[model samples]
Target: MPTLASTNAVEIDGLGKRFGATVALENVSLAIPPGELFGFIGPDGAGKTTLFRILVTLILPDQGRATVLGRDVTTDVWDLRRRVGYMPGRFSLYPDLSVEENLRFFASVFGASVEEHYDLIAPIYEQLAPFKDRPAGALSGGMKQKLALCCALVHRPEILFLDEPTTGVDAVSRREFWELLDRLKASGLTIVVSTPYMDEANRCGRVALIQRGRILAIDTPTRIAESFGRPLFAVRAGKRYPLLLAVREYANAGTVFPFGDALHYTDRRDGLMPDAIASGLRDYLRGRGFADVEVKLTAPTIEDSFMARMGEPERAA
Candidate 1:
């Protein structure tokens, strides 16, 4: 086992990777502090998983360097593996094994016993106790996730990496899972969670928005939202499809994206007041055969920030 040498849990510099002709990651760099809840926010195929795989030492980077717990991910892989916990995007527990069996298996891999590390995972394991005897395959999606989390923490690692932990779980389960992570962070555990859901970004202490193998921005969710430097509005009308097209075609449109039940829009005329923008949007939509159209000033969200950032061209390679 390697001794901790610094407060930074993970560090990466100019990291890049590729699979044949397909680029997976490019010029990526980031540093996660010990005990911080850091989030990698991006949509599917955004290279979030590729980054986690490299950081956890499961794969090699084509360029640059990465360190976890002060140990190089490539050169010090053996020692690094012992100090971090990883729950991949998919549920990877042995299907034939009972929940208890899976937990025991992971613990044994680290030369530890479940009973010895039970306290470390108790908060999450307690909810799974009743299903201890059930085969992992028989459990619900949420239960399977919990079992994976317990298995990941059985050895009490210094840093944890969860790749889209709440992807397929229900809304309630997602909420509960984040609550569990919050508890873990409160106990001084460093966590790096990647999620395609923008809403989850707000739950993280800091977030990095990634797209097409590049990092768009890295900052707190609040700061990311605040960085949207323009007034925004939620616009809706009778038909969303036509409304979306009309909004995009408007001469003064800055950015128009579909945002669940409404279109999130901003005006190119940043100097205009919110009320003026709203009034202008209504007139534009109504002129384009939209009826009962409504446009109201709205606050920016992490999703808004992501859309705005992604609209820009990819940085020079």
Candidate 2:
């Protein structure tokens, strides 16, 4: 049984939800401490959106229970809605409305004015102020996101839930968005964000990796990468395709997947030293007619850990 703690900003126990034949979430449970910039990391269709909807009081769970800010999400939904801010995965603000209109409208919905909580959204709102007259639909992807975030913050809710907030945005915009999140976290706002990008996981204080409606792992980015617990190597060759196929055919290969420009390889046999493994892999690749093969022991990243966990057998629900 999972228990909720008063100290926790958000808590869930044995939470499960299904959509007809599709299982959206299954026995998910976790506790997020207050003021923490927590993230739910996973690829598309990994139950991230469903979980966020439940936390933000937009949907009811089929089983189990969840509490946000010590209030039951299922029973205290109306109260929770008033205290929490949610920015859905899609752009939900009115497209025909000007930026300022959208902000004022959302503020009024919460029975508050933009002036009352100006300080809460100043950092982000300042950027949008210049384009206040512009229709939200006419703004760039990044600007639209900023506008949505400002609206979400206008009421100064205790916690903010952002679902894939950076998806479809430019690379530079993604970086800028995370910086805004850092500043928000510094202001002692508890933020719960979900993203499909593995690199974004590093920005979170802690992250939960979800796949196929199940929680695979949860920990700091560094700790999760450390948990890979295997001798890994980055193998690169002039001929990428051939090298990948060759490495996959190796007898000791546990996992081989293309990672950026190199193929990250892990061995099935344990107890072999890193140096010995690297040398063996290099020799094997060289024997396969790849004279330009470069094999080196490499530190595992959060993506590596995610891939490893994803390859494991699914846990029984």
Error of 1 at 299 (Å): 0.8
Query: Could you tell me which 10 consecutive residues in candidate 1 have the lowest summed lDDT?
Result: 1-10
Give the backbone clash total of model 1: 0
Q: Write the per-residue lDDT of candidate 1 for residues 1-317, one digit (tens) a residue.
A: 55447558888899999999989999999899998999999999999999999999999999998889988898888988888999999889999999999999999999989999788899999999999999999999889999999999999999999999999789999999999999999999999999999999999999999999999999999999999889989998988888888889999998888998999998887588899889988988888888898999888999998988888854443
Which parts of model 2 are misplaced by more than 4 Å?
1-5, 314-317
Query: Which lDDT tens digits does candidate 2 get at residues 1-317?
Result: 33344789998999999999999999999999999999999999999999999998888999998999988888788888999999999999999999999999999999999999999899998988889999999999999999999989999999999999999999999999999999999999999999999999999999999998999999999999999999889999887898899999998899999999999999999999988998898899888889877889899999999988987754432
Pairs with backbone N, CA or C atoms under 3 Å apart (clashes), candidate 1: none
Instruction: Count clashes in each candidate, considering only residues at least 3 apart in sequence or on different chains.
Output: 0, 0
lDDT of 2: 0.93
